[model samples]
Target: MTISIDATHLADVTDFLQGCEKVVGSPNVLTNAADKSAFLTDQRQRFTGAAIAVVKPGNTAEVAAIVKLCNQFKVPLVPQGGNTGLVLGSVPDSRGNAIVLSLARLNQVRAIDPINHTITVEAGCILQNVQEAAFAADRLLPLSLAAEGSCTIGGNLATNAGGTAVLRYGNTRELCLGLEVVTAQGDIMHGLRGLRKDNTGYDLRDLFIGAEGTLGIITAAVMKIFPLPKAQLTALVALQTPDQALQLLTLAQGRCGAALTGFELMSDLCLQLVAKHMPQLTFPFSAHYPYYVLMEISDSESEAHASNLLEAVLAMALEEDICQDAVLATSSAQSKTLWQLRESISSAQAKEGKNIKHDVSIPISRIAEFISVTDGLLQQQFPGCRNVTFGHLGDGNLHYNVSPAIGASVEAFLDQQTAINLVVHDSVHAFGGSISAEHGIGSLKREELLRYKSAVEMQLMRTIKQALDPLNLMNPGKVI
Candidate 1:
């Protein structure tokens, strides 16, 4: 239900906003309906919430002051970054009592310590900007995704996002060494130390990294960077099934070792949709296969070395009948084209129609079996339903989305979202997998989290929430 404040509460809200304006100028405090619209809606446009005001803090100090005012006035606030999150973690709820504390103005690269292999950046620094900065210093900040152009580092930390390079560099959590957080009590925790090893006590940095702003607001961070690879190569391999893709994965890993940076799995239907909607992106293969794997290798040696390594692996796979065919990207343009196909699946699915999406992960060994069993089960229940399955198979994360059946009404198909989620999530659990892999348990999966997690786990999470945010004001109604 939408929150309607009484006369006294409205007066209190006015006072709170006034305090916010004092902390972060009147111009930065946005209360107009139009001004707050963009921040209220989620990335997928599935939900649009209401908020009292959208406040943009200029820096860490301003953020702390605004948060302090929130405490004094007993007003809940939602910390938002680029609002590119799939789950409803970044947006406020339907209740209009809360305010959106935007960290967009906090964008800044504080330092780039190439010697230490770290980069210190504000929470609002655009992910692509961070990558570019690291590149400028001849270092690599390898956290990459479709939304890197607009998504912020703060949100990345909040969600602990996993991207393409996760096979090598790991998630946002693994990459980050320290954080500068504004606690629930509006006190700044200055922990931005660029250290690879520090076992002083409780890891406070970790607690806030994946807390989704429920525990505290991440203002800035010290993230690990790596030396740029000498050569990077991309290849697309056509495989008959998920199991074969897994086999090829095992083969590639055995052959390339650390050089295998990315291994993505896409179904033929995924590319079919891409071809249908994104006609401009030419499909490389002459014929189609049931499944495909996009393998990437980053070599510290020469380009010829990288190419030779990838070719040898593909040759072995083909000889063993593990894959039907392979296309090695000979040029940079060709490599980009190959990667585009892997990245464009989601957008292609969107252009086709509305669908239910599940960001799930399975044990690497059981992934193929999980897919086979789950697909069969789904087919039995929802006949002819289109499964647009694809994701970072190397990391065992799958974007196992479902589209409407041929000639099926979109609304009718969407109405079955709850039932569909039950089947998929239950199967994931049965196979020792996670319901939410890369995406955090935002409001979308809060109930599902409760259903899946043990009582002890739930209680422990609640305890942490209670201990950290006693008032339950920081991003209320998220995570736990």
Candidate 2:
């Protein structure tokens, strides 16, 4: 059902507010501008929207009741968690005809079964908190990202978030065992089972996992966990080019196999920016290289064993000319500092100037080609545009970002965003890659998705959307 924006019923905010208050007490319904301001904007501050009220519900029952009231009053709903999304999927629209349904108050660890390797957590629990809970139970929830400190599990599942560990533990979809969701019509579906081998019909759990709240609101979930690694080995290696990095990855994988947990790639330009902006950070090597790889290996054995394995792999890589230089972290603090160099790329880029970012994934074999081709094309068309590339190379996902030259006007560079995106995304599509790897198709890429997705695929998605959210009251005008 395609629901168009209409302001005719917005005048009934008073009654809607009263209904919401009845569902989740009056104090939880924030209507003032000051109270709703934080929920109205996205993490990047790229988009600011309006909402009739920002409602916080404390439990699944309250979430159901609040959703039920929204449906009854014909009010649109935007289910938000942490508001940490890169895409504008979590915020309300500018029309102020919707309600921002916040699940922060619903956060709680419902259950933990170490033997079963599953942890049941409420939707609003922070990602880092979930990781810590798993650690407390002698398990590991490996869906890690830089924003884990602020991003919520529900948001992670909603976006099907892919982080550095995707090369190993897989995305949020794979990490999840079951989900307790409130349907578009406000009916709670208690499907939070930790069974690993359920041949259930239609796979309803998956439908809502990456739906971005267009079909339903995720209230809680049971996620899969793994045994905690006894030791971790981190290394920062310099390479002449991406091809060399790729070779190093293949070698490391063959040498370490399942112990290899992370393989990140960054351009020398990225490291230079980090050095210039973040003077306190220490680089692994004194001289700069064109590319670098931050690789990590984890095992259920002694630290010495893991380190020996890593040293052996690095020795092979060096002898084979796959890497120019390597630094094996000698201590936990040194390992953290090496990882911080890779994690600080985004912040360093922000300090440079206006930038165009693309979260794309291509075939592992064609990653180097994609970078080379796109970089050349960008330079040719938009002269002086700096390309700062880095990402989870092991998973074929790259943050292929471009920024204007140091002295260029940010506004002028932003004016050409559409053209820049066309060049970058067109190359990604030609390489048989997805335009959005971790981030879902929020309003940012809705039109691009239509152009790229096959007609049959789009039709199938619409069919599901119609079947589940006929009224289109749940996060209308986003995703599909």
Best by lDDT: 1
lDDT for each candidate structure: 0.93, 0.92
List where candidate 2 sits over 4 angstroms from the true fold. 1-11
Stretches of candidate 1 off by over 4 Å are 1-3, 6-8
TM-score, one value per model: 0.98, 0.98
Q: What is the lDDT of residue 282 in candidate 1?
A: 88
TM-score of 2: 0.98
Looking at candidate 2, what is the lDDT of residue 382?
94
What shift in Å separates residue 6 of candidate 1 from its native position after superposition?
Answer: 7.6
lDDT per residue, candidate 2, 313-387, as tens digits? 999999999999999998889999998898899999988766899999999999999999999999999999999
TM-score of 1: 0.98
